[model samples]
Target: MDTPCAERSESYIPNAIVGYGYTEMAMQEMDEQGFGSDTPSGARRVSGVSSSRRVDRQTGRAGFGAQFRLRFSRSVMPRTQKGRIAGAVALFASLGLLAGAGYEGQHFLLHDERFVVPGSSAIQIEGNSHLTRAQLLSVFGEDVDRNIFTVSLAQRRTELERLPWVEHATVMRLLPDRLRVSIVERTPVAFVRQGSKIGLVDRTGVLLDMDDDSETASKGAPVQYSFPVVTGVSEDDPASVRSARMKIYLKFASDLDSSKENISSKLSEVDLSNPEDVKALIPDHGTEILVHFGDSDYLDRYRKFEAQLPQWHTQYPKLASADMRYDRQVVLEMQAGASVPTNNTQTAEASDPTPAPIKHAAPRPAAKKTAAPERGRPHTKLAAMGQPHFPDESAPTGKHVISSKPARQ
Candidate 1:
């Protein structure tokens, strides 16, 4: 379809006339030979005609169609330096976006107005005991009471928990309107008598000087009404006061109950000041009972006394005082001149001498023997008085004739 020169031109020039498979193989050979269209230096220096006619020097393979195919393939391949720069820029932009998003999220969570606390419309107190609702409200301070938004529940709990009677406490924010506090108060065990005033005290001996109210006082506070009045304990010694008073009351109650069980009279009082030598002032029995109870172990000693009391009462009916200081032995103090078993230990000796019987004159109108007064021996004398030696009918009231009885000598 062309002249001779035209035909040569057509064979070397890159065209669509070449079949697809041959063009591909020829292009691969040119690519391996370093003859590609992407090299701007190569494109400008080499004439398109010569480049199309050039052969792959190593493979001896080439054609205009093959060179054109190689050029197209090379143009499509990415440049390494440019591609790396683009990828790095994209990564940086993505990281910046992520960091900005995270910063915004944190700001919202920490300081946004949405997270601010709502105003307080109601106050929910723990209780009215120990510390009243009014008193606790005062501790919350003006800021917490005015603007509820700044109220720190944790801080409030920390401040109140320092109180000795408050065992534990929790402060909670009631959403939209209120704050509620719940606290556990320590139970008062006994009331300690402190001078003219009484202090409410707990089992641990912590004194609470709060005003008197039924709720703040312990359940057993009223039971201390009949407590023995004690002195010498100072206001500074709240712990010692509590310990001493509780010990006395507990011992007295235990002894009284045990005595009733044993048919013995109730104890008027029990003193624990000297714990080892506890003494009980018993009823009108004329003497105190000395009980040696060491430490706070009166409960055990009282039970022992109860068990042995009935036996002693039956054997020693005339006993004026009983000493149970030593657990194994019971000492009895009896009325003067009363007969006691010889085996028993008598604490006191006999007081006076026994009188000798007088010899009466022989019975009237009966046989009489002449009597002679003995001399040199201790002389016995009987003198007559105007009112008679013995009390007569005119003796002062409340006098009675008693037969001569030998008293202790």
Candidate 2:
């Protein structure tokens, strides 16, 4: 080797190494050249650093452990922003897998029959007064095994409301295969009469059934009649009441009929001309009188009429008609009293016996021509009764005064 000044200064260079076979000074020169040197002193130096043989052997080539360490340190520490992003992505992926598994498990547990309502679960039926346990169960279809919690509440309520009698229903879960159902049943209130047949109805007029015992008992007790029987405003005549007004009429008729014996002879027909006015059509021999009942005050009218009956029957025995519509006045129409028989005997001399032989003096006065009654107010008859010519005030007490003059056509 040639001596050089560049080699002479190598020992002081930090990047240089010197050893083995080469003299210390020569090693120092090689060290100055930045070259690795081998030394027999049981140590080795490469590029100014001591290293294991494995490291020295791997140092010249790409190391798998070094690549692995770079990746592993990034994964373990996650110190850099890029490393943190990778770590977050991996953590999110793991969490997503776990969440997916948990969601699927919950879905399967709730919907699946094996996990939710098993076959061994017990069921209970409540609010079953009219319906039996079997009847209630049959409504849910044959697929259901009577496990209450296993079945959906919405499904069970749908089944219950379908029943004919159930107006409303509720289904509840008791847990552990137990179920409870409550029901509300429709109830009847009255019987709506339809010709010969009657249909059961509620108070609101909802039709339920025909000839049902529940409806009949709820509506009314049985009533018997020889003539026609009508319910719910069968007639629309002026003498009839409206449908909604029939309840009071039926009740009153029922009560009146109970006392038939006292009123049967005097009353020919019951006229409901005014629902408020119960007119009694009474017959006096050949003629009839429309006796107006004062009002709904039936007790007072009945008592007054009952007291007047005895005297009227005797005095007006042959009277054509009588009007007792007024509280104070009673009008009498006489068949015999109005027309009195007048006998005219003309005296003449005759050859036969008896009272004709006696001649009487000639009468010197002429009778005045009598005018017939004008309209219903008879002037002569009114004058004979010694009363001023005014309209008849023979109307029922409390009734508004009506004009006696006929309404012009």
Lowest-scoring 10 consecutive residues by lDDT in candidate 1?
A: 383-392
- Candidate 1 deviates by what RMSD? 26.3
For model 1, the superposed segments whose C-alpha errors exceed 4 Å read 1-121, 145-149, 213-292, 304-325, 329-409
Which segments of model 2 are wrong by more than 4 Å?
A: 1-80, 83-87, 94-98, 107-121, 146-150, 192-200, 203-206, 209-409
Compared to the true structure, candidate 2 yields what TM-score? 0.31
lDDT of 1 by residue, 34-105 (tens): 555563222211233344355443333354453443344464434798987887899899999999999998
Clashing pairs in 1: none
C-alpha local distance difference test of each model: 0.46, 0.41
Residue 42 shift from truth in candidate 2, angstroms? 66
The candidate scoring highest on TM-score is 1
TM-score of each: 0.40, 0.31
Candidate 2 lDDT, 105-132, residue by residue in tens: 7776566554343332244666654455
Q: Which ten residues in a row have the lowest lDDT in candidate 2?
A: 378-387
